[model samples]
Target: MSASNRPAGSGRLLTGVAWATLLLGLWLWGRGITDGSGASSAPTTGDIAAVGRPHGVLLPAAHAPIKGTAPERIEIPSIGVRAPVVARGLDKAGGIDPPPFAKSQTVGWYGSGTRPGAAGAALLVGHVDTETKPAVFYGLSAARPGAKVRVVRTDGSVAEFTIDDVQVFTRKRFDARKAYGPRKDGRAELRLITCGGTFDRASHEYNANVVVSAYLTGEKPSAGKSA
Candidate 1:
């Protein structure tokens, strides 16, 4: 049965990284990063355009080239989030693992994919809530377009991206390719993901996944790397 059609509490618990496993349909069957499709490809993934709302925040407009650096931290000043970033690999189930629930204040960067600030879509995933309370990305849905997301890298470079889109996709209709794929061939982009929408106590799952899309707008190299 489709996820949307399922009863509120009819969620399944899968093995492996519990948080990431909750999204088995996401990182596994839904990933189409190279499909070149967007939110319009299918009914399940919902409509990306519908979720993106304009905002009044001002952001840098200068675009930067990809640096391929390993991100160490992420700061979304608009939402008052300043969290350490840890490298995460997929579990045996192919689901990208998130930081342990105990580390609710941290986020995870997909070490297998394009590094943040690179010329492709970089993915960052986090938990919205744990079994008992709020987590790192708990307020991610409150972010607005034109807001800035800053990523500090191991190389000492800080990549700044401008938020332009945000949407929540239901697991059943999730189109991984369209949601994670690049919209432009060479533009550096970002996708911040976490569980969103209503929580299903019976299903032990979230009704949808929040996806925040951004693009590299500027970069500042560490003091030593600065010319």
Candidate 2:
């Protein structure tokens, strides 16, 4: 994705700090963000064209970044996703250890990375599906640009993000920096990631990843009501 994927004039750089950490994060993320169950199931990933906003869908102005806060839950009304958030770190293999398959409905935040509502891009990852059923982000690909994504934080504030871009990047074209970096400097951003593309039973993993990019556009003291 590029500036065209965001509202005009919203460009930013991936600071050295973000770049260096993302290098290691991407290493594991690109190898395959999540594992598969191998059993045949309906694919949940979307097409590559999912990138960029739909023609004429105007987006809202960016909201000033807020103080760092831990996310407690995530809600995407467009997709009917209301899931609890959990903090997860790198596994022994150096890859982000996502919420276990048994907890398919949970979302995992990169606890070591940027906190939600902060300047850097906060990353939340989840499984797309399992051998027998759909997972937390199963309908993520179906989410359209301009839709709202609300993150309930621990500080009694809710970080509201507007969907700006959604892309399905295959392993070959998965650029860690571009996929995970902030779209606008100094503006709070969020990246929702999950295994996408066709599930290769032989390898037991998906061929691509669904990356949903959003930027902070609103906030409230708590999840009092919908925006």
Candidate 3:
């Protein structure tokens, strides 16, 4: 969806805003989410109805999407998060795969979507906790506005994004369309996701998710690209 043309309930999960055209459809295909929650029931008829009427917007031409090098690492200093970024693809169920439990400190980039320095919203997902302890994004829900998220890419450049907002969405109200959609049109953006809130022992899942929204403010020089 266009950044300027967000559907109704725009700030929410479902114009499911700016991640990219294919994001809402493919990214949410969860492979048990890969940790243990298993597949989710399909959205209701209302949801199916709302998806058909998406919105759009136009922006100044300067913020065109730039193709970026594949990312290698991600760093969030305030939360003491620094980890390797592995390119993850869709699992059979269709959700973007997350970092495996064994590698608690790692983060996973949705390789099929926008690249770090690219024009559209790039997605990065990680675990909030594992069976025994907190995971790499454990403090994700605590992030406040203006926090910096740095992505080091293969071209030796660093994509720096500033956190615009950090929100927690409950499983019951999880709107995959809104959560994965873009907020601003024509600007490079990022969405960092992880589980949050209380863990539901009955379902073996986190009751909520922490979604941090950021935009490309600048970049570190590399591969002939100037700062």
Candidate 4:
């Protein structure tokens, strides 16, 4: 989702580093990030227009209750971030839903895709700014290519990903197909998202959205044995 599509709120927006850590932490908290269920009451004309477009396969239909557990800790040596995380789902309105962050608490997952290590683009989105204050993901614009991101899952598994690129696009120009399209090799990926660009008081949202693309390197085995 684009920044303009996000819900209005306020606070210090989290930087890219913080957002990554927050997602990892949410995984540790037992909040399943891949539980994609609950269909909207009715599809709008716009939704109908999007049908048959190659934006990627729709997630499965199954909404499991969120367990109130913190995600495992995450450490990104490249960005110098090590913190806890949480998970959350999108609100009734369609947007890049975010979780609450305070007292060292990170936001939760958007819960709209397969698990992080699954064979698809596991989406994790957060807020960039609210009405009164900057929200988490404010610093998302600072990320650069070749950066490293590390996530620890609740199953005592560690996944490492490398930042391939960062792109910023206007709300109108945003392409879900290219942004969330299926990978050629059928590998797992991470798409970290947040709002960006000039904030509009009238709209109470940023003009653009910042997206960071990362490809999974490999998973660490539970046992000492290397995979």
Candidate 5:
């Protein structure tokens, strides 16, 4: 889901224009795989339920305070991404708000969902392209299985994950069951999401969303120690 590959859609979710706005704003502000270790673990039924419980819901305003700062950093040498992560919540519309896009800044986490490095599947969503310009996650589609993803948390801890799979789903066909679905093992997982698919000229947005799934390989400061 690199900025160049961002898809189109209507004024739904994060508007393409808004995405562009976010990217442009960031640029003005400062600016800034491979080899598999066997079948990656899958989400357990309970894990899936936890994520789906809040499907399409916006994060409470109270959580907005955590929107900035690097709870972690994600890197995929194969795709050339090594951005710090922040926390982001949904706007009044129940869709994720744009994440910070400045070069030195970290990407945002969905303040509404489980934090990355948590026990369950931590979810993060960003814009592939806000407008015609490339935004954070613009190159997400290039990532492949076996790529490495690193997360550095606020607690001075870091967790490493390996890319398990990359999937795309139409907005209408988006199966929340699968998007936030649980793994059978309850292993910690991460899901990075962005808009993708065909761009609808009339709608000015992408027809679908792109999703990247990864699993924790190992981490410093221990896996579930509130990092």
Candidate 6:
């Protein structure tokens, strides 16, 4: 189920051409995206079939974009995730390198892209499970709209975001731009991604991906600093 703890290279999530395609979409359309539809053949938690903003759910307004520093840590309160963030770039194969399986609990940020809390969408990827057990983002599919995600920056500010959309996009229907691009211009956005759907025995990979989208709602000043 864990792709032997190797989520990227072993035909899991961000495999060779798939990763390149994603980056291409990100480059072609720098920011802003619309909602899409689709579902996973193998559902997890609840029905994850392209769950967008729930009806009647009033989300907070997007916070103004801020100058962002490198993220030191990330917290998803609903999922009980508190993990360190590490910068990751393209590997030799030209695909976005994910965090090593040995450090399955860590989160990998696309260092070359927009920083979290910045004007554009920041990309954060993690493994859903390991060979032995669930990994960092195991409960990502269960995350619903209105969940809170907090990113602690190196500069000491804590950027808080509210989840707005969650989708289980199958490989055939996955839109890289929609999954990773900003939802609105001039507002900071975040995407939490992991492998989802059922594991394909033939391909040795997951059939779908779980993408959780969020936007900055507020910022807590650095510790001991006046707001």
| Superposed Cα deviation of residue 5, candidate 6 (Å) | 12
Summed over model 2, clashes come to 0
Name the weakest run of 10 consecutive residues (lDDT summed) in model 5: 59-68
Clashes of each: 8, 0, 18, 27, 35, 0
> Global lDDT of each model?
0.70, 0.72, 0.61, 0.49, 0.53, 0.75
lDDT of 1 by residue, 25-134 (tens): 44653454333223432111112222465565565664866668899999999888899999989777677766765677788888988899889889888867655566
Better of 1 and 2 by lDDT: 2
2 or 4: which has the higher TM-score? 2
For candidate 4, write residues 1-227 as lDDT tens digits: 23343344324343333333333333432343333222112211111111111244332222122211223654556544565556656445333346553422243455655456666666666555554554445455555555667667776667666666566544444445445544444666777766554555454444445666776765565565455
**CA shift at 93, candidate 6, in angstroms?**
3.1
Best first by lDDT, ranked: 6, 2, 1, 3, 5, 4
Runs with alpha carbons beyond 4 Å of true place in candidate 1: 1-51, 55-62
Candidate 1 vs candidate 3, lDDT winner = 1
Compared with the true structure, model 1 gives a TM-score of 0.79
In terms of lDDT, model 6 sits at 0.75
Model 1 clashing-pair count: 8
- Show where candidate 3 strays beyond 4 Å: 1-65, 223-227
| Candidate 3 C-alpha lDDT tens digits along 1-227 | 32245333222111112122123334443211312232223222111111111134221222344568898999999888898999999767455655655676788888988898787778888766555566787777666566788899898888888777666555555666555656777788888876554544454444455667777877777868765
lDDT of 2 by residue, 5-44 (tens): 4233221111122222333456554565623222122234
Instruction: Report the lDDT of model 6 for residue 58.
Output: 87
Candidate 5 RMSD computed on C-alpha atoms after optimal superposition onto the true structure? 13.6
Between candidates 2 and 6, the TM-score winner: 6
Pitting candidate 3 against candidate 6, the one with the higher TM-score is: 6
* Model 3 score (lDDT): 0.61
TM-score of candidate 3 against the unseen true structure: 0.70
For model 2, the stretches where C-alpha displacement exceeds 4 angstroms are: 1-51, 223-227
